[model samples]
Target chain A: MLRSPDLVGKSQDSLREAFGKSLILLAEDYPSLVVLDADVAGGTGVHHFRKNFPDRFIQCGIAEQNMISVAAGMAETGLIPIVTTFAVFLLRAYEQVRLSVAYSQMNVKLVGSHCGLDVGPDGGSAQCLEDIAAFRAIPNMSVIVPASPIEINQATRFIIEHKGPIYMRSGRSPLEECLDNSYKFEFGKGKYLSRGSDLTIISCGVCTGRSIQVVKDLKELDINVELINMSTIKPIDQKIIIESAKRTSKVVTVEDHSIIGGLGSAVAEVLSEYHPTPLKRIGVKDTFGESGEPDELACKYGIDQVSIKNTIINWLKNETKG
Target chain B: MTKSVKSNVNYIRSLIVSSIYHAGSGHPGGCLSCVDIVDYLYRYHMSYSFLDCDNVSRDRFIMSKGHCVPTIYAVFCDMEYISLSELKTLRKINSRLQGHSHRVAFPQVEVSTGSLAQGFSFAIGESLGLKLQGYSNNVYAMIGDGELQEGQIWEGAMFAAHHNLGNLCTIVDYNKMQSDDLNENIIKLEPLQNKWESFGWNVFNIDGHNPNQIREVFSAAMSKENQKPSVVIAHTIKGKGVSYMESIPSWHGSVKLTEEDCRKALKDLECTDNEIEVLMSA
Candidate 1:
């Protein structure tokens, strides 16, 4: 349990620092634990783990394919391995992750750092906007997107305890702290950040904080908005999503990923399959993002909080007209 | 711990031929080539418990050359992990014996192997995982010479050596044949031993059919430290036992067997009356 001081306070760096520290601490408890890095230690924030556990940390030196196989072999020997790399490199070993870790059901943790278009000015190639959808399609995989540093730390702890394989998404930019340390975090449950009846906004990662802001802004306009932070994408909080679609009759899904297969698509899957509601999907629409500031990209792509607010208002007006 | 070395290679040849003939649709060429090498590992120098296959610390074996699943399956069945009756169902639908194996189908299987080159990586991860957990168990991964054409296999090879994975052992079944042709005509891994050695492995070359030589090298590998992962370059002949099939690329995978062909292959092994009865029953 974390304290209020630990709440909504730390940046992504701080969260990753804490995660590295916690990982080193966990090494003491489980000596079988080993950390692997694919040349993104400082970027992914696992430098601390490398520093503290030099003997256990395997630096695979820029080779993503080898890193994946080595990690798989390590897992086969009964050790719990945590791998860190950029989203693009992780995709290089997608087949390895799928066949070896997921299909074989080995215990391995893959931390996809600098996910989405949050790598600031790194541009499209460096930014991993499609990672969420790419990993979500892996069967028998636990997909997690932590909203803030607090949630990142929580997800870190959660993944270590949970059995099987996991793909944890980490933000390149520091996100606002949303949950206090005392907040109870579970793997598959959606956090109902605020409650409203008129409309529901579902989001996760940095976009979750943005969705909360949209809820606040909509409230000022007398539009009672319900905001849900969906942390787990696969085995998504379907109950809340369907319930929200049923109550609000209109749902706005937001994420810093492609609308085709990311959070918006996941939410839409539930709605189309069971609850058919009018949905406004907020994401990068079938196009790669350009080199710009994280905020600029979000605003330009119409995934910012303001865009979410405007879309919800328009959807409401449209419903009334219909 | 186990030290298994065969004094004679003839026994393995006989067994491999008999098994492939019985199964009818196995990768006989590759399986024959790998038989002596695998036999050496199982018989000579690995510390794995046959009874406690589920032991977390027990040594693990992975067949990266998944098309040759029948070979390993036969070896395991001979070792009594499975019954002979189950051996008859190789490649049959709704059978534990799939063309590739899954642990869900068999308890002794640590990892499911069907897709090529991935098994080596899986073995590497599992090996490191065991070592990280403070377990002394080792992992043995086998890859086909042809399967090395897959990019991921090289990735696994490089990683294992770079990490100085001392408890890991990888064996290459250099039968020199691919699915449709010889490895040289395809993608040649000629400086194969040099490549592995360059990537920081303790490479050993052996006559793959000679079980004793394989056992001795594996034993040496087990005792060494401060070295990279070890690879035994087992020089083998594809379709080792049958006179006509040996070193033939077409036998890589096929159902070329008829009753007459099966009888001829079986006759070469000098099957006993009791063994003949067993085969008939199966």
Candidate 2:
């Protein structure tokens, strides 16, 4: 029952930092907890965990594949090993994660930091736009993308308590705080920040904050839109998504990832199979991202609040005319 | 080798041949090659009972070369983890004994390992965990010479050495042959002993088929004098014990065993008619 801080208009905090902090807190209770990093402790912000719990922290040097398998082995021996590295680099160990962690059903926590175009100057190679899809395809893997710093902390605690393998996504830059102080995190459940009747905006990770801003800005034009944070991308909250789609016959799915097999594709699968609805997926189309500022990349990739606002406005106008 | 150890080795070889023959497909060559080492580990080396397979203090064994799991399954049967009758259902639908080591199907297995090189890493993690937990038990991982081609094996080697995991012991069934061709033709794993030594392991090269040599090497590996991880590079013939299959790459995987083939293999192991009858019936 951790209380979230008042996150409205406050200075943002890094989700990666919160991940390290949460590990410190979790280690206090679970002695079996261990942290492993692949030469990215400073980059992923697990340096705090390393500093605080030196004995509990394992620094695997520049080997993502071995790090994952080592974590799997640790989990096999009844220890909870949290493995952190750059999201893009995690793809190098995709087979290891699949066979060693997921197929074995080991209780290893995989935290992929600096995900998507938000990695900014690190460019297309560093940015991990396909991690969610890669991990989501693996059986027994729970894919979670925390919307804000507070949600990241909550998700961290929730994953440590919940058993089995998990893949959690975090960003490099500080993200806008969105959850209220009383917000309680739930696994595989979506939270509606604002509700309206015109249409529903579904987003996760950093994009959820931008979607909330888009909803607020559209309110000036009397364009009432609902904002839902679909955090758990794998075991996605389909009940809330279907209900939201039924209420507002249109949907817009946004994420700071590739539109092919990410949040957009996941929602599309749900809607097409269970409830057919007119949907517009607002995220990176089939294209590779370039090096730029975080905000600049978001805008260029059409995932920022302004892009989302314009896309919805145009979609609404067309839908009404049709 | 003691009389009982010799009997155990022969029984395991018989089981491996029979299991693969019944399944109509499996890596019989590597399984036969690695059976002697597996037998030594289970029958003499490892410290655990069948009734208490989940004992925390028990030594951990990981078969990294997962295709050769019939040898491990034979060891498991000897340990009474599963019935001899169940070994007949090796790759059958819904059988607990999967084609490879599956943790869910067989909880006694340290980790599920089929996709090569990954299991070695798991062994490293387990060794690290054991050390952190203040456990005195050693962790043993077995890999194929061909599996050394996978990059993760080197990565695990580096990590184990870096961590100074003295409690970890890795065995490589250095059979000259791989699936399609000789290891030298496909990937030269020669200077393999030097590779492990440079990675900071107490490397031991031994005749894998000789149970006495395997026992001596394992004992040396377990000695408290060594401060680094140990890897026993056991030189063995692929498809050992079976004359027709020995040193043959075609026996590496999915060898369709005819009645004559089965008889020839069992006869090579010197199985009696009654023993062959029981094996075939199962």
Q: What is the TM-score of chain B alone in each candidate?
A: 0.89, 0.95
Candidate 2's residue-wise lDDT over A22-114, tens digit each? 777677788888999988899887887788789999989998989999999888778999899999888899999898999888999999998
lDDT of 1 by residue, B10-33 (tens): 444444555555566667778777
Best by TM-score: 2
Expressed between 0 and 1, the share of native interface contacts present in candidate 2 is: 0.83
DockQ, per model, reads 0.59, 0.82
Misplaced by over 4 Å in model 2 are A1-10, B1-6
> What is the C-alpha lDDT profile of model 1 across A96-202, one tens digit per residue?
78877787677889988777777769888887888888889998888998787777777887888787889988767766676666766679988888888888888
DockQ-based CAPRI category assigned to the predicted complex of candidate 1: medium
